[model samples]
Target: MAANIVFTRIDNRLVHGQVGVTWTKAVNANLLLVANDEAASDPLMQKLMSTTAESSGAGIRFFTLQHTIDIISKAADRQHIFIVVKTPQDCEKLIAGGVPIKTVNVGNMHFAQGKTEITKKVYVDADDKKALLDIAHKGVDIYIQDYPGEKKTTVDDALLSKVQ
Candidate 1:
């Protein structure tokens, strides 16, 4: 099992091969919080992800907003804690729901209509960018990186290109 969640990297792949095997080891995540509002309501989707994500070592947990907060707080002694969100708006919802957001670390948000044209890398909309800034203004460190080693993108950089 990953020792204690030190990281909460956002990967849409969720508990795929690379995520379970690679990202798990990298983050030392003991409890994996898959925090997708959509996935929470669907039992089949939850089952699939939960089953697929099962590792003999790491404990896989799927949480809706309420449960996620309970578990995260309950498991505070955990050296490393990870909470996952599928979209930036989802991130906003969690914060709005009072999850005590520490930061928003982005990964692999692709091109979409109304989104700010980030490099060839990712696309984010005004809603997403503003939500990010809101989190930042609240004093959370919003950092962006695609993988284990990439240049970190602050919310300012994300706002720079299109929002201006």
Candidate 2:
């Protein structure tokens, strides 16, 4: 029994104010899952995420990518889920591992050493663009927007090529 995934977002900064409050309410999700390997293993980050969730009034969990793949189905049956992954590549891996990711929201991925800016908030390198293209090929809609009310920039082939 997989949990019903109401929303999926790719945000480097997981469990932030907007995600803790706005997106959780928008999706009507009770469970906020931070599915990132680094964050799940770090106690400091775990505490911070928990503290953020306390204010949002949403149940939150953290799991590494493999752990998420193992437990997501059963968890979904119990709670309406909202998942946030740290990168597009992670999201792609999750989808390949059997999570039914119908749509992916690219929120905030900070500028890295080898990455170029595609949008004001999104920066990607060749690998990132490739991962996003792969996800899109699997029939998942990948779009960018940090806030709920803002316009979503779809990551179509044209946009991906431009970035690459």
Candidate 3:
């Protein structure tokens, strides 16, 4: 059975204090899944994030893109999973891999040299824009909100046009 995905968010800083405590509590999620290729391959990152999640009273797991697709696909229905990815590209992959993601919350994408600010917490470059637009085209709802209580800025044509 597909995993009970209660929340899916794209935050560069995955499984941090805000996510592990605030969002997990907000969503009432039991599991926190960090679906990032770099984090999955690094033992130090996994350990650190695992410790954080445990401290927050939520079970945590780090998986690569393909591994996330494989594992989440077979997860039990009772496991309320909160998925966090670093980029929109990764979010797109999860949907393509049949993870059953319907809505994506854009939490934080830190400023980079080539990126432009979309919201106070969201900055996107060309590639990021393309991936996000593709995801939107596939009928997925995308919005930017830093925290659970904040207002969400929907990713629409007007939003995409502002990237350039």
Candidate 4:
């Protein structure tokens, strides 16, 4: 990917087969920012995701949470970077480290054993929801939009906006 694709989204699944097959085309994205420390450390994980994406041409870069903070803070190029994270805590960490993202589009996060329902498509456990709310309060526009055209339920401002 080109490091310039412009979808600032997060999904625990990160860039999976669905992302490559669907969202890439839909959003016209060319750069993917995989923001996860573990993923950055694991070369195999990077290779696997790249393969899944077919590495057809899109630029995919995996970065530790801290590095991601620096990258976003300094760059505003044209490639359309899709910033991704596995959970709200990860997102929180990035921001606390000094990354200032303005919006976050949630792609997917499945319900684990004990998660609360914030919306039809959003589910957050107590601590995670708190973190998410904190991020929202900081002016990040958190939205749940699994696929293209899916109704985007806001993570802030919407009265019913609590990641369930």
Q: Rate the local accuracy (lDDT) of all candidates.
A: 0.65, 0.89, 0.89, 0.73
Error of 3 at 102 (Å): 0.9
- Worst lDDT run of 10 residues, candidate 4, spans 1-10
TM-score of each: 0.78, 0.95, 0.95, 0.82
lDDT of 1 at 70: 51
Name the lDDT value of residue 135 in candidate 1: 72
Tens digit per residue, CA lDDT, model 3, 1-164 = 56789999999988788898899989999999999999989998888888878877899988898998887878888789999999999999999998889889999999999899998888999899998998888899889988888888998778979787
- Ten-residue region with minimum lDDT total, candidate 3: 70-79
Off by over 4 Å in 2: 76-78
lDDT of 4 by residue, 18-50 (tens): 676577767777777788999999998898888
- Candidate 1 residue-wise lDDT, 50-97, digit = tens: 665575256677777666655554565654556677776667777676
The list of candidate 1 runs beyond 4 A from truth reads 1-5, 157-161
Model 4: CA > 4 A from native: 1-5, 73-76, 157-164
Model 3, residue 16: distance off in Å is 0.6
lDDT for predicted candidate 3 compared with the true structure: 0.89
Better of 3 and 4 by lDDT: 3
Worst 10 residues of 1 by lDDT: 1-10
141: Cα error in model 2, Å: 1.4
